[model samples]
Target: MQEATETTHSTAPQLAAPAAESSVRRTVLLAFVIILVALLGVFASRFSVSPRGAASPALLVATQPALAITAALAAMIVSLLIALTLAKPINAVVSLFALGCAFAAYAMQTGTISDFVFLGANFKLAALETIAWSVFIALAAIITFRVGGPLVDVPAHNRDGTFTGEIIHKRALMSLLAAVLAIPVLIFTMIGASKGQAIGACAIAGVLTSVIGRMIAPRAQPILLFAMPALVIGLAQLALAFATTISPDIAFVNATLSPIRVPMPMDIATGSLIGVAIGLGWSKGLVKHEPPSMHDE
Candidate 1:
């Protein structure tokens, strides 16, 4: 009887190990689902403005291409900032906030699609695009964080500090060159009508991302920076394609009047490149550093 009890007790932890792991996985999945639901809620809220409502010419003109583009860009930038900030610890509350911000960003970008009452089309492509973009960006950012390892927050320093200006200059210069070089590669890739622009863009983006990540968090690991960009740009292309096929009038609004829209290959290339630029640009900052080693004689 004692032997049997000992055996059961000894095996309990072994059995619990798998259960623990499964529980962790379940928790993570639940968190992700909650985040998705929050983002969906944000997208659905666009209807509060009554996308199906009619508007006067003045009202329509008031929300022109320029203002719309600016608003959309602002929303995306804000959401990205929030996401990067919240990504470090992966706390539930912060993650949910980041998810909301991300959805808001996509919602802003797709506002024109949703608010195109003039089109007279009942298609809910706008909401769908918003949802798709939000989910894509959120997942991409999370994956990037996971792959990149924990983000190290380094302190900022001016010239003559332990982190010399030279080092900063070097990293900055390298990242800038990478970004600059990416432009021509992107342009040529687009002009040649090559499908490899995505690859080229991703490569450049990765290099720049690493540089920026290290700068932001001195010990930050290398992550897939291009994923988010690729997803965003790819989805945009798909949305445009859908719009074009569904209704020429809708396509015209999106293609011609929408400042955010670009031509097929160029649009994809540009959107992705911009995403990379934003990632790199914002990442350029401070990071925590290890204390200097001591040398005792």
Candidate 2:
């Protein structure tokens, strides 16, 4: 019995090591991915805004991009820490907030998908931007999968051939809420696009979304892993624009429009109320669905 027990113990680690290795690889890959997303934000800001460190007229893109990237990176890190650690309940609250901010930013900056309310975008991607988003989505899948941990669904042969409902895992849901902590980063994008104190407000919106989703169904984890860099750089750049009064005076026909706005931070009372709701009201909220397979979109 002693010898048999020893053999089983030895084999157990061997079984576990592969998953551990995969986890390490995922972490490294995600770190690199974080850097890449930040760089993209930097690049995006170079074209639209006249940043402080903007070098000579010709090579200005390189200098201006870094600050925007840095702010995004900061938001990404903090939000993740909050979600993965003590404040997991805030996920759902932030998710809705982020979802709203994303569409709002898109609306404020690029113009609506259509003049008519519910249709496709009037302005599609600039080819390169579309490609960049595609790459981001792929990276997001890797991040989401890593956070969710190992999956061991029933085998196809043992399972019915016909489709059945998803097999939900509690650990997966917890991991997802942890991951969705990166909420503030996306709100920055809304701030970047807005015309008033929308940046801080949008940043606050991010916090609110996490708070709300924490109340509702729990914002999906994938929302945090990718959306962070997307919004933060925009937020940073917008804040900078708002600070120095450097934004373009976009004209509608003749008169110039008002300058861009940063979002406001939520009041302490509101933040507390939302946080309490997220903490108490929807403790049982679950991530909506399992992420798509790694094979493709």
Candidate 3:
């Protein structure tokens, strides 16, 4: 009987794997379908875009589709890294915001911005942004079981149905809002079919990042959550600034980011400011978790 029970326990989990896989497969396929519908709209753009839209159209045209696609893939990896460092609500929101900004920037630069319409993912770089932005968002939503620091609190009802727990994050619905806002980015990620695979990879990576971040970040919250990530980002920005100053890449430089330029000192200051902001924000919502009196789960 003991041997039979052990074999049954092992088989039950294995049996469930295929069903879970199927569900995931279906979800990804649905996402692709949504992407395809948005791509079809790109063909409907009213603009009669000329072959030489700019003075040096040839030079602009010289860059390969491959390079653009590669940058996008790299951007996905960066997005994942950024997502990994983010707090649940903040992380997802930041990714969606970043991708949306990146998409808008790309559209404006390419002169493909349509003022009259809000057609989704009609411009270049939109699909990749969409996929990556949504990935982390989805993952954040899935892990509803949050395990944050002693700082954050989850809402719960008492045995007598009284509101017993402090819920600071209820108003901060990061995952849901992030996913909704990421729709356009998702469309852009697949606008170019060649990059479909990388975009998917980004989404998968983002989701994985969210899962890992959710588990790890909260545990490291009291110490490294704010400090470590901010420090690292500051260091990276400094490096990027130094590299660009020494040898600027016209394609790589962020036009809007120039205002807050870079360097170790500036980067460190910016990082310190960000850390301070996080510290202050979390502190304002600080709540203590007492031992549960009763559980119905």
Candidate 1, residues 1-297, lDDT tens digits: the string is: 999999999999999999899778756754664455446434433323333342211112222434433443454444444444444444322333344334333333232422343545333333233334434544544444553333344333232343224233433333333333333433444322122333344334434544454553343222223333334444544465466544635554454432222222212322443345344435545444655323100
Ranking by TM-score: 1, 2, 3
Write one digit per residue (lDDT tens) for candidate 3, span 115-172.
1011221111222222332343333322221322132433232333322122223222
Give all candidate RMSDs, comma-separated.
12.2, 14.5, 15.5
Name model 1 segments beyond 4 Å from true: 1-86, 90-173, 191-297
Off by over 4 Å in 2: 50-201, 218-261, 264-297
Clashes of 1: 4
lDDT of 3: 0.30
The alpha-carbon lDDT assigned to residue 9 of candidate 2 equals: 100
Per-residue lDDT of candidate 2, residues 175-244 (tens digit): 2343233234333334232323333333343344444443332322223323332333333434444444
Q: How far is candidate 3 from the true structure (C-alpha RMSD, Å)?
A: 15.5
Per-candidate TM-scores read 0.34, 0.32, 0.25
Worst-scoring 10-residue span by lDDT in model 2:
113-122
Candidate 1 accuracy as lDDT: 0.39
Worst ten-residue run, lDDT, model 3? 115-124
